[model samples]
Target chain A: MAVTKPITRFTLFGGVVVLLLCLSVFPSSGQAPKNKDLVHVEAYASHKRVNSGKSFHIIITANIKQGFHINSHKPLDEFLLPTVLRFNETKGIAFGSVCYPKPKQVLFPFSPNHLSVYDGKISIFAEGKVSRNISSGDINVSGIFTYQACNDQMCFMPESVGFDIPLKIVKAD
Target chain B: MVAVGGFLIGIILFAQVANHVHKIFDPLQIKNLVSVKQLFSAKIPEGVPVKLPDLIITTIEGEQLVLKELTSRNRLVVVNFWASWCSPCVEEMPHFEKINRDYQNKNVTFLGIATKDLLSVVRKFIVQKEITYKIAMDDQDKIANAFGGVKVLPTTIFIDNNNRIVKIHKGYLSQRELDENLKDLLH
Candidate 1:
């Protein structure tokens, strides 16, 4: 019985060590990437218009990969950061306020609170007007879009993306 | 039997140690993806003197109340816009309740406005959380629009005695943040 006891103890200890090794090698779902999931940003205009006196609207859309949601322009709470859009202005081209689409409500696991966010795709409308004094040429508008992405378990660091769009200015009379 | 007992003891000890490790590391796992400063730094545009729409809501006590009347007094009004569905808003309720109690004797009134939610839900939430403060229901979101389209839940607007909006705080507030803002308004 004394010999059996030592063997049993050794076996139990070995089993525990092996279990821990397996856990370290393969982490559980909770330890998986909460926000490393890829998010795609795409910009599209409803209609291509030559720069004219009339105002033209360009839509910028962000399409998040499945199983992820980006914080909206306005987050429900302080802990959840808001997405920001910076517009680089040109000398003769003027841009209006960037309008954001309404976001869907999401519930996080760690937090019982529901947050407003944009999952899948969100469209932001940017309207620009060409000045009458502007000559016919290609006008470039560039800006950095910043936002934080999160899932149920954790939130990822905020990412800033830069994009530029060129529009050909044409005289309309 | 002694070996089994020792193994059991080891297992228990391991579990206890793991639990402690988890507790210590759980908050560290929280990546401050976006710093709290970013949220607080969002510039609240100057308060424009636009005519605010009148909001009539039923309080948790079933009292029908008007929003403008609540602002008639020279009290520091903390109007919090939230919904029962919001997690951070619910998590911060107890803190808000404590703030209300702390400032009860002072010249301050903390009002919670339930926006984008049904009255039944708000009632159940108030009862479940044992919220003692007066919660006004903004049906049809008219009250939310009146307050410049709350845009997000858990948005708090601090108004001074003169009915001018002194500061706007967007998001869940810790007890300290609430106390600090209230102190500024009171003083």
Candidate 2:
């Protein structure tokens, strides 16, 4: 019984060391899964370099997975979830209305009415203006693109894929 | 050496506790904390009975039939409106088949209406999916519009023996949900 107390303390110290070793060996293994592969997004700026206070277009091209289509930003049905783009507030940047390409009218076999949907590739354009006071350098304007994709037979869970648009703010001529 | 043995036992006990905690607090299970009905935003009719719509559709087999003709057989009719491109609609087909098989002898009918789909695609999909229930194609979208304008995929309508619509279930229905919805029809 006398030796049991020292043994407990010794075991505790050893357990702590083993736990630390395990953590060091497998860093980032316990993190929550990331959003990948469901949908691919590519951001583009109309002009790589724009004068301060001048407006430019940021185009986001979303390529849906093969055999799948996402509902248009303005879905014909009220119940259907529409694709939406939300921009995060950033300093020295002013964003305008986002314009989405018109959806192709698809009349599925199950319904007589045509649905508003986008398949393969769809582009969303956003107008942005750099602040006059901003310095001449590259800056990123990030945002989220959310959509629900469905193939010929089933609807997948909705996903929000993040996107970043890089633009260079040059001094006015 | 005895002290080391005691430490090993303590480690095992701690491991067991951690596992139990993980099971109890699994976030994946908690992600769907909202009610099942919240999955869709559609305004579905519940319990309030309505008469079956008078609409005819052509089956993929090229046979023309009215939906009520099947309902008039004095059995509970489950009309599911689905499309080949609708993912949720495809996912629930197997469950519908299983339930259809179980109620083979019972006075029940499962009718799947393929709307806005091509006949070639529907024929190909049925063979690939091995669908066993009755499938009809509404190429003209007449049947869909008759059923209160089926705007959503996987909209299931339940009609009683009296040819009255007992309920309209919108969205995907799990096995348990199917069973729950057919309680009046089966039992």
Candidate 3:
């Protein structure tokens, strides 16, 4: 009888350890969705090669998850935060005026008023100028994209998504 | 050895209880507990009872209408600041018109003031929306600035017969909330 009691206790402890390990390895489905999963961002250059001192459009396309919409650069309301894209200044590349597409007017229940929003897929364009003295090589331009996403019911916290667009620069004759 | 086994079992049991408790409370529900008023209160001024500011705006017909002049009519006036691009403003227009219809003989008037929109677009929107209330164009945003600046679209200001700003509502208003706020104006 004494031997049986010890064996049962040892088996119970082993079962608990195995259960904990399994739980840790496989997270439950009830967990909140990660911020990155809500939107997909891709940055690309309009032209692969451009002469130095010439300007080219760098386009950033954002694919927002279904049922979610992001605010436009000009939200038209003071309370709403606008989506902004800013590029880091590189030695060989200079970013110029950033242009945002016209946003659709969406009336959401969560917002007390109408909001200018972009949903599904939207493209933002920025003009990039290669330095007049730059050599012929591929230059990588990195930028940060910030936006606030919301649905009809509620809005998620603002998130910043980083992107890198590669461009080739040719020497200006 | 026995003490270590007991401690491990206690920790495992506690974790199980914690996990179950977390599952019972939906995180989204917890987040929704924060009211919209609390979220916007940081920027939206509180609705304090004060005299409505004197302002004038041009109607779509190019006639000037002064807000203070409407005070002597011995009626409740509902002033709504909106733009054609604002979706919430469009959605609430019919509701306002409906309420206006209900109290047409109660000495209550509903006025819609369009801001930041071209008169052509405002006229087009009014025709499309079938809005019959008094529509005014605030091209210069003068009327909006006088009423403490319209930071949000679809801001409705309720004025009593005395031209006192009784309630200032910010955001998209539901039928129930509109009715509740208009209780004073109605009866």
Residue A123, model 3: lDDT of: 92
Go through the candidates in order and give each one's C-alpha lDDT: 0.68, 0.73, 0.73
lDDT digits (tens) for residues A1-173 of candidate 2 = 99899899788768766765563465332121222454688888899888998999889999877766788998876456689989999788999999999888886643456779999878999999888988898888899988877655445546788878778889886
Per-residue lDDT value at A45 in model 2:
84
Q: Could you estimate the TM-score for every candidate? A: 0.43, 0.45, 0.51
* Most TM-score-accurate candidate: 3
Best by the DockQ measure: 2
RMSD of 2: 16.0
lDDT of 2 by residue, B51-79 (tens): 65576767667677666776778478898
How many backbone collisions does model 3 have? 2
Give one digit per residue, the lDDT tens place, for model 1 in A1-173.
98899899789778766766664575332223433345666665454556567677777778787776787888876444578777787778788998988888877653655778988877788887778888887777677777776555334545777787777778776
lDDT of candidate 3 over B1-187, digit per residue (tens) = 9989989877977688566444334342233234545333212242332566666767787767677777657467888987765556666778888888987887777889987677877877788779998899877767877776665567787776666665566666777767765774455
Record all residue pairs in model 1 with backbone atoms less than 3 Å apart, i.e. clashing: A77-B171, A78-B171, A78-B172, A113-B87, A114-B86, A114-B87
TM-score of chain A, cand. 3? 0.77
Better of 1 and 2 by TM-score: 2
lDDT of 3 by residue, A25-143 (tens): 86543233455778899999989889998988889999999987888999876545689999987887778899998899876674456678899999999988887888899888899
- For model 2, the stretches where C-alpha displacement exceeds 4 angstroms are A1-58, A61-173, B1-49
